[model samples]
Target: MSTTTTTTTKQGHPPGLYLLFATEMWERFSYYGMRAIFVLYLTQALLLDKNVATDDYYGSYTGLVYLTPLIGGYVSDRYWGNRRSILVGGLIMALGQLLMFISASFYQNFSVSHNVMLLGLLALIVGNGFFKPNISTMVGQLYPEGDSRRDSAYTIFYMGINLGAFFSPIICGFLGDTGNPADFRWGFLAACAGMVVSIITFELLKNKYLITPEGGAIGGTPEKVAQIEDNTPKRSISENIGWAIGALVLAVAFFYGANIDLIGSFIFSLSIIAPLYIILDKSLNREEKERISVIYIAAFFVIAFWAAFEQAGTSLTFFADEQTDRVVFGKEIPASAFNSINAIFIVLLAPIISIIWVQLAKKGLEPASPAKQAFGLLFLSIGYLVIAFGVKDLNPNVKVSIMWLTSLYFLHTIGELCLSPISLSMVNKLAPPRFAALLMGVWFLSTAAANKLSGTLGALYPDEKLIAAGKIPSIFGFQITNLYEFFMVFVVFAGVASLCLFLLSFRMKKMMHGRG
Candidate 1:
């Protein structure tokens, strides 16, 4: 390959879309499989002190998961190509799954030994970091600007993600929740199957349908590649070793129990993406900076939306498992299956949402990006309020019905429809062409921040003791108890955020000029 192909599927994209489709499908399955059990394992299996407030740990863990893509994206953009990084990540993740499998099998055998499982989780984190960002970038590579299929392509891609989520809980849950979920290695094995399927699917499609002929993996003959290398910038061997050593140290720290916060601490510390743009401004004119400025504003609003919505993995999941009765057809459902409800809703509604966007845009009535996001926050605020009201006045002797949780997911799904996909399009539209991928990275960083905060916010939920411990004491004039008071904090916070965002619409739109 002289110059690696970048795709631009205009009217109809290539069949390679299916390749990414299947690959992402399984990858998400594995991810959801692991996720399905993460909180459950922590609260029920590992028996950590859930009441002691583990939100920081969970927030840091999930946050870091999103954050690592920055490192992975940078590596792919600067040194290795997307294809190689994806392959490496897949293999490493497979091993991590194997480690998890071993950990489960031997949980009682090792009993107190945390090293065996901790190391495996660390590997998965690094592997996922390497894999996630690069793959998304490849999807963009498959279609150029103005490709009619591009937006539809992404919507379809998201569908693949949900497809995995849809099946994972049912399939893995059946295996995992058997007699005892805590020590079941079968769940880990199911997750491993997902990674393997993803790796194999992508590997086969790398040369065929997935990539076009502009910028992609480089595997040219020695004579062609060798000549270009002589003029390339060179770094000393010691510098290379220093970088390697740093990466190794990070890996070590990641494996430790609590130090895993190092991921969130480090990634959160990188919220200064603006400085990088400032430095590059010497090469850019006035128009580019204004364009990039819009991206940052949108990125900020999205962080708030995701932070609230992502509670599905943290607080909401906890509520489902602990406070709500998840019986369906007279049998109790695994709490994680509730997690899939969003994906299932997305799978069913994404096409309809896409159609609505098209019709709205055609009629010159498309909502401003800021408005869409603000409305999304409003949807989330309402979702939380629904739960707040639904769970109120419970007699303290019984669990709430599953219907309340289901309704909450439905509202969150609506908010998700408004915010998530639209934001992706908005960011791509607002970013200047040259820094497209970098700005996308920034957008992903915002998601990382919100997801991280999702974990942090989770700690606010009232555990059994928190209620019984009288933490919800009546303050002066008001009385609040159980999860109701805790959720009210978010309800008010989100409602205010939505209002502020709505008011900011005119200013935010002006920042975008005519971009979207």
Candidate 2:
């Protein structure tokens, strides 16, 4: 492997970090702004059933969103450089937002608007695939190998993400959630503006700021892959054809999941198959295979963590809208405003947690990445338990205090702090440099599966049937009529996954080959 000498920069971080930060912040603003009202739009604007909206459309859209990153990362690594991919992705996403604005503007024409919304989602999904992984890969490239600043840089970057997230709902929700149901186009237009800002920031500053202290640009595609080609045999045409066919089949299945009842099972099946395909590939050496094994193991745990965590955008949003009391000081706040709480907590806590990691590392007390992720799952489980308790035996006619939902988001935010950034860094560190973006995309497979699971689980949220009549529903003989019963499913799922991951941490760490 060719090694680059470490160059010093101010504050132990390069200036490129801030540029990427601003770029990601604005991108996130555009994304979360759209997400904040997506479910509400499905239900109110599109006039879909709430249960179906969350279960099918929301689940399928989100699952596909994460799924496209695999293609984006591969194309960027093999054809487009990171910078070009990011620019193209940002522009596409901006266009997507514009399409969504048109969708909202044409809300009265249900057919035209619905088709437009689908097109917008496709654009956003394709664009995000290109933008998300490459930018994060660029952040890792900014620091040389073995630099401690990488984690802190990501935390700071994460804060940028949340800062955008923190404000998006307030801005977009306020504009979108006007008492008039037909005015959502304003919110989507605001999202489009955010995307424009993101692209402009990236374009204007990349050459000036996206470089090492030594003044060489970073994240351009390398001319040759020195490390990966060694001892790897090239695939034959038939083998390549087979792989293409397989990918086509997976794509067909994913699209079918929108209307099919069996998508959850298909996603779970793909979760296993996708990692195995990577691990068993002859192109990878033993070291790469072993390192990827850690990602695969981590991916399983990822499924559980995100399946619960992602409730924020769907089921939890509904809960906030339907069950949670949003009144404070004689004012009824919009339920969608609660979507910002997780971001607010992330913004508030990211710096604190970054410092904690630094201090712990100085004392040689920092937990291994796997152990930290286990803690994340544990916290996720605890968050569910909190809400489960808060809503136990609650009346349907009266709304529960908003604190229940707020507290849940707070706990989930801490769990996210422990898991998300660590996992991102881990993938970059472990992946073969040649396939860094591809592996990052692979890492998102867990999220794709988890989102599908989340949608399926969201289908189980207290339906009007249960809420109105206080009837208990059963899943595999376990009764879940009340809010407590419904949430306990996540408590058990996350709690058990946390325990399993905790047990596997030592072994997974060993498989990491000292990369940590």
Candidate 3:
């Protein structure tokens, strides 16, 4: 069996890291730019109801976006490989963006526009499935096993992701989210251009830079490499099929019992099933299974974190639009631009956070990955708590100071710094080489569930019209009559999840077998 090797660099990291960084930056720019205006375009241009747009359309779209990575990962592991999958996915996404531009151009004809937009979204979801996991998995391959710089490298890569995210909303929102609906096409066009840049950048540079230390090309087709054989006894095909069938039945039951829509139920079901399938692989020994278990456990906790954090795209965006004071130096800021705050904070703070991790590492005092993630959930809860208090006792018609929303974003950025990149690095460190991309896809599966839940929670946003009609929104038996109660819901979810993960961190650290 052969394994990938890492190159030494005077800058403390390989040059390939920077190449991947620039590639991912533009990809994120395309993704976040389109996302910044998706809901606004649906509601304002297509004139869909808020709840319908968020719960049915946006939830389903984003959920599927994450869900299909399972298929992409499997295909990559068996056939396409990372480089080919990324190129194909990028081209597809670029086409998706062009379709969106056309959809926005035809916004006046709702039926035509809606159908075309759906097709475009389908393209984006499928493309992202191929693109997301492969790129992330490649980042881990850039370093050898147990390298101290791995975590810091991921943090730096995360900053690249945010750099793109930070500018996208400002540019996209400025072009598309102006009061007039006709301008949405310009935003989609810009996103299309970003995707094109991403594709070209990767294609031009990958052969030169995406290589192992010995100058062997990385992420080549799986068949081209000599692989370690998994000789452990495996489940019979019939038995495996039986398990899959059982999982599907449970998914349907959940759909009906939980009253979540089809997409939500599907995402939630696969989030569990996919991880279980990987764990059941007969090739994994006791230690490998335990380490993988930690990934699954942390992923479960992450669902809670992102369900709250992702409100930035839906409920939080609504709050910024309707409730926050957006006036700045005598001009009103576009609500969609508020999406940039978290990303901008990430760009500013990621370096400091990266430095802290390195400094702590040198002294053998760095917190374990699980402990760091718990702190992330804690900060997320605190962020919501701050906004909950700000919204307390306020009249529905009266706008609160923008500072409240900014504070929430600032805190959430800290939480994101703690959790998101760490989880990515954790998956990379803990995953076996053969299962690398597949496990990355499983990690994203949790995000699929969270994004769906975010939409479900976003639907619970207290609409003033609904409140006036004497119909208050509720979740898990708690009534949300106002913005304060709504915000508190997240506070409770994240706080409880943080506590639970904290208690489990000690055990999970032991499971890692000293890897962290």
Of 1 and 3, the candidate ahead on lDDT is: 3
Cα RMSD (angstroms) for every candidate in the order listed: 5.7, 3.1, 2.3
Which residue segments of model 1 deviate by more than 4 Å?
Answer: 1-10, 51-53, 109-113, 179-183, 213-264, 273-281, 432-434, 466-481
Q: Write down the TM-score for model 1.
A: 0.84
Task: Work out the TM-score per prediction.
Answer: 0.84, 0.93, 0.96
The sequence of per-residue lDDT tens digits that candidate 3 reaches over residues 83-110 is: 9999989999999999999999999998
Candidate 3 Cα outliers beyond 4 Å, as residue runs: 1-7, 224-226, 229-236
lDDT of 2 by residue, 1-516 (tens): 222434344347787899999999999999999888888888888888766888788887788778778778878887787999999999999999999999999888999999999999999989999998899899988876777677788888888999999999889899997766687888899999999999999999899888754578876765555334555676679976776567556656765764445655455555655666566777888988989889888988988999889888888888888898887899887767788999999988888888888899889999889999999999999999999999898886778988899899999999999999899989988988888888888888789888887887887887766456765446678866667888999999999999999999999988899888
lDDT of 1 at 396: 54
User: Per-residue alpha-carbon lDDT of model 1 for 163-256, expressed as tens digits?
Assistant: 9988887677677755484555788889998899899988876786654535443311124323444554545688557655655555555546
Tell me how candidate 1 scores on lDDT: 0.71
> What pairs collide in candidate 2?
472-481
**For each candidate, what is the lDDT?**
0.71, 0.85, 0.89
Worst 10 residues of 3 by lDDT: 1-10
When 1 and 2 are scored with lDDT, the better candidate is 2
